[model samples]
Target: MAATVVQLTESKKHIQHTHRVFEEQKKAFRSNTMPSLAERQENLKRLKRALLTHQDRLLEAIDRDFSCRSRDESLIAEVMPSIQGINYTLKNLAGWMKPSRRHVSVLFQPASNQVHYQPKGVVGVIVPWNYPLYLAVGPLVASLAAGNRTMIKMSEYTPHTSALFKEIIEATFPEDLVCVINGEADVAADFSSRPFDHLLFTGSTSVGKMVMRAAAENLTPVTLELGGKSPAIVSPDVPMEDAAQRIAFGKAFNAGQTCVAPDYVLCPSDRVQAFVDEFRSRFAEMYPTLRDNDDYTAIINERQYDRLQGYIEDARAKGAEIIEINPAREDLKDGTRKIPLTLVLKTTPDMKLMQDEIFGPILPVVAYGTLEEAIHYINERPRPLALYFFGYDRDHQRQVVESTLSGGMCINDALMHVAQDDLPFGGIGDSGMGHYHGKEGFLTFSHHRAIFTKQKFNSGKFVYAPHGTAAHKMVYKLFIR
Candidate 1:
């Protein structure tokens, strides 16, 4: 077992490296406790320049990692969002860094109060395989803008992209200021256990539990971007074509490997067939062929491919109707790992597809008798990371918004809410917790330290020692009511 010995050696090496780098980052952060706004903006600008300079290489690495990842999809989903996020951070970081002044009460007229957004010492970002570049860059932008040293752990499944990212980051930033760590599961576990001021993990809910538990050992604050079965609700009054097209895009983009992708659709009972037909039509228009189409993205690996295929088989065995929308009718079993948009009808709660977050190009359309029933169905389950409502009726939209709870919601669109730089992205309950993006992202990695100042006066001394004194009684009588 020479391979086993080699693997053990590599694991030990990675663990030791992680420990050393972590301590170095902590020391670096202590040296420069608070970086000026100009420094943070310059860091963002350098990051943006690096991403643009090596754009082609980054795309090629992602394509190689997936075996058949779409070049255009990489640009649209990964590169564009990353660059935009950095620009957004650069433009707004100055305002975000300014201390927020608080109003002092009349009883404390001689004092001033404010909150300084100080950087937490160092931040740990664990990136997932799907959309690795964007996920890593998104959190990294926020961490840098908040003036903290960062250590990124890239997914081992995407070796090509992960290695390339590490190279790019090393060339652009110093080890103590920023570093990238790459390894397998054991390495990830070790990386998670390292003490950091804050940690942000983006991955599956099951694995999220392990990361959170590991972080708990050090009482590390974490912002988990976990995924669940995000759903899209189609209103009876909304046009089937519009709803179907948007949902199809959400499900087909990157082969539905997105965390916020619409996992299922709750369509009106009588319109289920119509919605299916429209969805098929729209998806075909986008991807006429699967096997040879460079526009279509393949699953990351054979294991993931098998897992998706197993879901389809399990649903079929459970009596669900499986509809494959392969417009060209090509044989996709050529080991390309490309899966067409497969729709499941009449899905039962017992099926694996319904129980788990289907993170592939599989959409399950469940029929609901009424809007109330649809709301009831979603309310019964764990709150999703994102919920999409496709309808034009103002009253119905309001009803859905007021009735249910989710981490984020989009009206008349799917997956676009995440692209908006102004909004915060996060989850609730089992889906995930903690917000990031824009100001929320800056605040997530920062500590709002409250400060109170007084000069040549001591208003608080009146109530300090003698609680029954006249000054204390007057102060209490003036404010306690």
Candidate 2:
């Protein structure tokens, strides 16, 4: 078919372009192995300017891509964080770049030791569709701050945003210093397989596995920001209204299309109905209506829309109580891809809603008899990217913090930990690995090279040639003991 031939031709062209840009970035990084502090700051400043200038355009593009992404949501979730991240990086880049002095061992007297954070050449960022601009720009800021040339791979699912992002990036920086690649799954596979100095991927865990496997072929170090079933635990004593309001905001923001969004809530058995009621009330207050609410965001596409709908049906069929919080009770099935904030009660372990990451406006409330039971439930499963506890008791908070392990945690809050400019954001186990944001971001993209300086000392030489010398014996006796 002619369509098939054209598709093949386009694929081939995208592949070729990716390869060419990757080589160009590597070559550019080679020429300037370490950029000065002022240079890095300037680069970030330029990026900030571009973002501010194209803020409206970027919002429109993202809205078009998602069919009905809220303009304010896009600005808050994507644009604001991106610009703020750049500002954070610019302010702290100089301190981050300074070589850190290390204490030398007594055995190596008269030697100075330090670690030099050098750039890791070219960094490849594979952005996901959920929060395309933030994911792409977050890692790009870190890579640039670390003085590395970068090539970004925008998600094909968000074609409008991807094209606009590529255009903006190209207009701002030279192709060799910064490049953007737009293509489908095959192109993403090819991009991951390329020999980038470092790669950062943000997406689903399954696709993250494929990206990691591809990067392994080149031995490329990766920072994966994968998503999982992040859970929030509501304490028996904490005000249900307080916990519900926060969790509702987390779930309803961008219609819950967030990597760190609360996937489910683990509440005390007695307060299940109370917690659900509060959540429903808070969500209704936030949206009030879904059909024509520009404040609410729609699912990204029909496929994703169908997937979430199927989840509701599957859970319903499996004996879970379904509660749809449509305040106005308007018809949302008019091809708008808008789904009200739905709650699934009494979800079983085997249900798809419980087993997988629910990256939508669906929240499942699992009732736990006690705090220990809640902790046990979380520990029995793969570690999540984020964990939330909503109790005011300091001892209980400490117990929760000390007992569980996750990429990040929030006490008395949800999803706000990620917005903090100073905290390092990442995941563990199935959720994800490695970190970015704050100083960790700079460190992730940098190669910490140890440096030892010995001016005229021969301390190492004293024990180099002779095996049984007096100095060696003294050294062994004094320090070894």
Candidate 3:
């Protein structure tokens, strides 16, 4: 009973803290409604410097949280992309901030139309645990680029990294300009419920729905970067060795915890065994051992580890052949949470592995007799966050691009599209709702307020009143047609 009282008190305190910081940011934003190009550029430069300065600490902290996340992976996937995003924003922000002129209709002569990109007062970003630093910093970069102050909420599962990130952010900027919030699910709910000009969330689809519902209370706009069963299609013509190696790299990176990781592979039916064999060989070459290999990352926690194990056990029990790619045949019962690259073959739709997003190192290889069958299989399921097609044929690529829909696609590659600073990153339908990264990100956190001006001429006055005068009639007759 006493614990319940303590819990309520702490909840109230968190709510108060969130509100206090939000109001402070609001007041600060009102003081400088529109920051100049120079100011925004300086902010970006400072952010880049801070990130680089703390790069080592961030890598270590994330490593601690994940038990043993690969330092190189953290640098390549998290830090490098963040710095590149900032550089891209700095390069294009000046032109992006300029008001775009629009053609005024003849009927509205003597008037000019243009769109002014203005900052939304305060933005809320809810970061996920998968890529703690990248997810938090990515949205923060876009928010600051748009001249809006941001309050970020980090995932509780990554306590070490979240705390370290909070320190980095505090040292980098004043709290009123940008701040970080750390807590559990309840705290996240409170953070999302607060009225903000815009909100961005990166996590699973289920949690995204709850975040959207909370945002709806204040009619807050949201950009959800959710995950799904993203698939990689291996064309029959492509060398099994080439396709298998690339797919292995994608699935093995970060232990396949990435939101856009290739969830499963659709390989040619006749080459299923060959692809699996090549995948196993390629993965083995990457890491000959798992438990002691620092290059291999552990599952974030026991719960996630057990969840993935459960998927494999369930599939095995349901008659799905399980191939554990442990080249060294190391016993996994040790304290290390590293699970080998397990492949489930002959999988049926009723299995949980097929029903859910396997956000782990587990890969399911489904067989398809023809290209149309592969495309149809993907189309029947929920649209994925990313789709990978391995082929040199331009016509097949074009057909895949036109006939199906996904947030992003990679031709003859995997997981590289999200790294492009110029392309928008996001999902569609059940996967997610919106796009961010590069210009789309800046626009997401901004309000493109449309404006029209007249040069001391009341041309609209002719159509204003007097029950449709001759001028109005003429204007209407000309434009109404």
**TM-score for each of the candidates:** 0.99, 0.99, 0.97
RMSD of each: 0.9, 1.0, 1.5
Q: In candidate 2, which residue ranges exceed 4 Å CA deviation?
A: none
lDDT of 2 at 69: 91
Give the Cα lDDT of each candidate.
0.94, 0.92, 0.92
lDDT of the structure predicted as candidate 1? 0.94
Candidate 2 lDDT over residue span 1-481, tens digit each: 9987887788789999999988878777778898999989998999999999999999999999988899998888899999999988888888999999999988888899999999999999999999989989999999999999999999999999999999999999999988999888888888899998999999999999999999999999999999998999999899999999999998999899998899999999999999988988998899898999999999999999999999999999999999999999999998999999999998999899899999999999999998999999999999999999999999889989998999999999989999898999999989899999989999999999999999976788877765999988887898886
Ten consecutive residues with minimal summed lDDT in candidate 1? Answer: 458-467
Structure candidate 1, residue pairs in collision: none
**Model 1 regions more than 4 Å off:** none
Runs of candidate 3 exceeding 4 Å displacement: 1-12
1-481 in candidate 1: lDDT tens per residue? Answer: 9998998899899889899999999999889999998888888999999999999999999999999899999999999999999988888888899999999998887989999999999999999999999999999999999999999999999999999999999999999999999988999999999888999999999999999999999999999999999999999999999999999998899999999999999999999999989998999999988898889999999999999999999999999999999998999998889998999998899999999999999999999999999999999999999999999999999999999999999998999999999999999989899999999999999999999999998887888984799988888899999
Looking at model 2, residue 59 earns an lDDT score of 97
| Native-to-model Cα distance after best TM-score fit, residue 133 in candidate 1, in Å | 0.4
